[model samples]
Target chain A: MSCGSSPFGALADDTRRAVLSLLSEHGELTVTQIAEQFTHIGRTAVSMQLRVLRDAGLVKERRAGKYRYYSLRVEPVHEVISFLNSLYGASLDGLARAAEASADQEPAAASDAPDPTGTDKDTPRWGISY
Target chain B: MGNLVLSQQRHLALPPADVFALLGSDRTAGWLFGADYQALRVGALVQFELPLNPDDPNGSTVDAFGRIASLTPPHRLVIDQQSPWVGRLICTLTPVSGGRGTVVRLGVEVPEDAVTWLLRQRGYDPLEEPTPPATVRIGVLTSKSGPASVFAAATENLARMAAAEVNADGGVAGTGHKVHVVLRDDASKPEVGAVQFRRMVAVEGCRAVVTNVTSEVFDAVAPLARRLGALLIYTPVNEGGRFRPGVMRLGERPRGQLRLALPTLVREAGGKRCYLVGNDYVWPRTTNRVARAEIERIGGVVVGEQYRALGTTRFDDLIEDIAAAGADLIVSTFVGSDEARFERQSYAAGLRDTTRTLSLAFDESTREFTGDDAARGVWTTFNYFQELGSDGNTAFLRRYRATFGATAPPLSSITESVYEAIHMLAASGALNTDANLTELVSAVRAQRFSPTWPSAQPEQRRTGEKALYLAESIPGGFRISAN
Candidate 1:
């Protein structure tokens, strides 16, 4: 299925968000399985949501004999996630470089030393692990 | 039981046997933080290779191990972990009605910090972050239908008023979070109350639940509170039991109220023969047991005793038996509308002319429902009465009438306890921080409610608060005894 023009439209509904979270928690689930988790809504309504997600390329549908299974497709949101990762990564790199440059310019100046996370003064604290 | 617990539940559209198959599959490692093992037998080892960074596919991993402590096929599984995530993990699967699905309950007995770390690794925020104040939601569960609905008449109004008052006074102590109250109706049934109680905690995110339902509901939801890591505060007179951690049964016990009311009632009646009548339930049965002991100690003879179904309206036969037994005093443990019906029927039978009745659950709303003619000369015991002559009570009554209008359901000990419970939670400051069970109990013990609230003092150990005043019903309201 094509991701249509805008993926944001498909993410606007509350049920779709919850469906996405459930799909993320469990890698894959059948249409009936998803419907069971949400007793408040019917099977037809869940199928409609899955169809919406499939149309938006947010989830992949697989057919096995008489049953159908659905799983979250990370491709549509992968672009946005990679962009955010780069944004944070670039900011951290720039901060570390700036601190290293300042430390090198004033090697003997105690005030200009970068605050290292470890005991070694050479290691900068700006590397992203989170 | 461990020092901390992390619990989650999911409804699967599969039977318990199928769910057990899924649990034994390798796919579970996806949600269980990379804990991989397909062995379903007891004493099998499971190794955890949890990702250090969930967002990065090639990030370093942390290693831990656990062994299967017990494995009950298609039902329960227990695993004992070592080191970093040191505790036990329990999984239970139960088949739902109609044989269409199963409900899976998972609990991890680990420290709070370790759970927080695990959540963070799973791409979630830290569990104990207090920055950027959150609105503390408290759930109020009261009966709006069925037999005991009358007891909850003022519960919702009083709880909302207390929430508004707490917010106006700068929210819970030390936290700037505004107070939010989520009201739910239990329908006076234990099963419905348990469902609503779970919804309030799991779905609505209520930090603590203040219940104005019967003790039957309390028994149903007490275990759920511990499993869900939320507080259950019950507000009603009860036969106190060995309540579990994370549950605060803040209601008065029947023993204390009986000790205060039976003596005066017996002395005024000028007889030692007493009859006991109540609805069939744990609270009623427990109260009767205490009454039996108290009556014997006070030199009284047990004349006749009987229990009726909760919503039974026909008391003619019971009243006839009570009159035939020649009892001078009667102890009525009937609750809500049942209590009112018994009083009115007894009055109609002319049993009230010679016999004195001491009702354990009678309050202003019930007396109003019973009317002045039938309720007059009836004795009751409680920690609060709207007719209390105190400046704090006067101000409270003024605000209550102004907020709910003059025709609102009259406040009684049962309803007043709901208001006091919210303030008690605020006083303990348990809403702001992740306080442990001991810290919570001690913090609550150190608190004394305002003069407007009841003077009942919470016990040092397990039992709830206790302070009783004997009152007699008059034309308009009740006259609380000086003692």
Candidate 2:
């Protein structure tokens, strides 16, 4: 991972996400074990993805008896989760404000009032701002 | 031209023979899924079955036919593939200095699409290369959530497939530049779309945007595209009128779809009383307005008209009103989930016994979601359908199904339009530069796009005028009605 590269960037890849899920489920997995999970990609690709995860601090490596085992470290993802929470929160706020603004523009009594022009056109109603 | 060669080298903690053994015979099947040849030989035929989903081992698989060209155990192995995408795969194993581990050099003579797809499958950066190609970022905004989510299921997949094909065929008019597709979800809201649109252009440096969201999102993002100097192309059915500068519309217009299908539908149904139903939006409102006029021109009476909110599932009362009005012809402009629900509810109410429905936004996916029993006999018109019998359509569907397995979401006009739009943008070559909106639009209009890939005899059409086909819902899928 380089400067300004978020952990979410590491999670963007399908295989990486699968690997993380596998590690999270199994607690720890060797490179060969992780590679066995993916039939389309080779062990070389699996190793590269593990390296990326390690660099992003999304996974930690533990070497024992001439073999390396990788485990999940989900600290970096907490930031991303919080960011998503904030995004949803902000959108809800914006939606509430939009609804309030539309309510102010159109009075409640005017909603049911028939068109005086006797045309098929609908009266000015408060839109949902889609 | 010969296929491009992709090279990879990995140092493994194994001897030369051990490493060679790993990539050969039954061991090779561990990664390749299924290989017929156990002991590799020079003249032996090799077959591989690559799983569509790597996570699901017992799921569907795609066959890869190949023949071994050269084989030297512990040294080198080469194979030539014939089916799917033609390629020559080579693997070389070399012993380390101390015989501690072996160094493997793997190279595949394949198209960029295959190489990128392989890289992507492995969670590697597909665009990352030794000598990285110049990239033209294109933002694709679709409704991954909200009312239109049902219709947008395949938009992202089809758009990515088109971009991959473009890159494989030497990238955007042979400029040696790759199109990097950046996808964003608008949540079926214009406000969210506008935010995502700005982020794509400003933060992500996108030069062009292809949208599969609602028309409301277009109304919000069109002006922003002009101000930001980015090309915006909206792909899906919409009310056609005027084109905004820096924005291009490449979908079936309401006028064309209704004109071609309504007359035949009304005549066959043997009714002149029409009930207009749609969602309350610019598209549905505009479509209903046009539908009303078309109904009158054909000496038909407008029995009833109503616009419900988006995502309205309950059509119980609406069905009662239509039944009470004794509507013979039903013109439905409801979209996605709403469309599916309306079709189901109306069919359940036995409305189909007396009334015939002409759905403006019904596609293969919508038909499937609506269920075959409920959606049967419903009429729809669009520029493209997955059930089209044309040779070009067959090849297009074959390629699409090959890329995304047989069980993948069915193709729809709404989804197919995104593929066409992406191809058109790449064909223009304006994506490879910082051209202004006017120049981009002109360049795009000057080019024609093929709806099918790897087509020997392509059915090319301009975005302005595409051939429309009328289809009726049948068991399993749609039946394209003969004009």
Measured by TM-score, the strongest candidate is 2
Q: Can you write out model 2's per-residue Cα lDDT over B293-398, one digit (the tens) per residue?
A: 9889889999999989986869999999999999999999998868987998999999999999999999876786677789987999987878766787788888
Off by over 4 Å in 1: A1-31, A35-130, B1-133, B433-438, B448-467
On DockQ, the leading prediction is 2
- Would you list the C-alpha lDDT of every candidate in the order shown? 0.67, 0.68
**What tens digits encode model 1's per-residue C-alpha lDDT throughout B342-421?**
99899999998779999988988778667678898799988778887766677788888888654456789899889988
Interface RMSD of each: 22.5, 28.9
> What is the docking quality class of candidate 1?
incorrect
Q: What is the lDDT for B242 in model 2?
A: 78
lDDT of 1 by residue, A1-130 (tens): 1112321111134467567667876889998999888968999999998887787567899899999989877564333333323322332232233333433444443232223310121211111111
| After superposition, candidate 2 runs with Cα above 4 Å error | A1-130, B1-133, B448-465
Candidate 2, pairs of clashing residues: none
Model 2 compared with the native: what TM-score?
A: 0.59
Record all residue pairs in model 1 with backbone atoms less than 3 Å apart, i.e. clashing.
Answer: none
TM-score of chain A of each: 0.53, 0.54
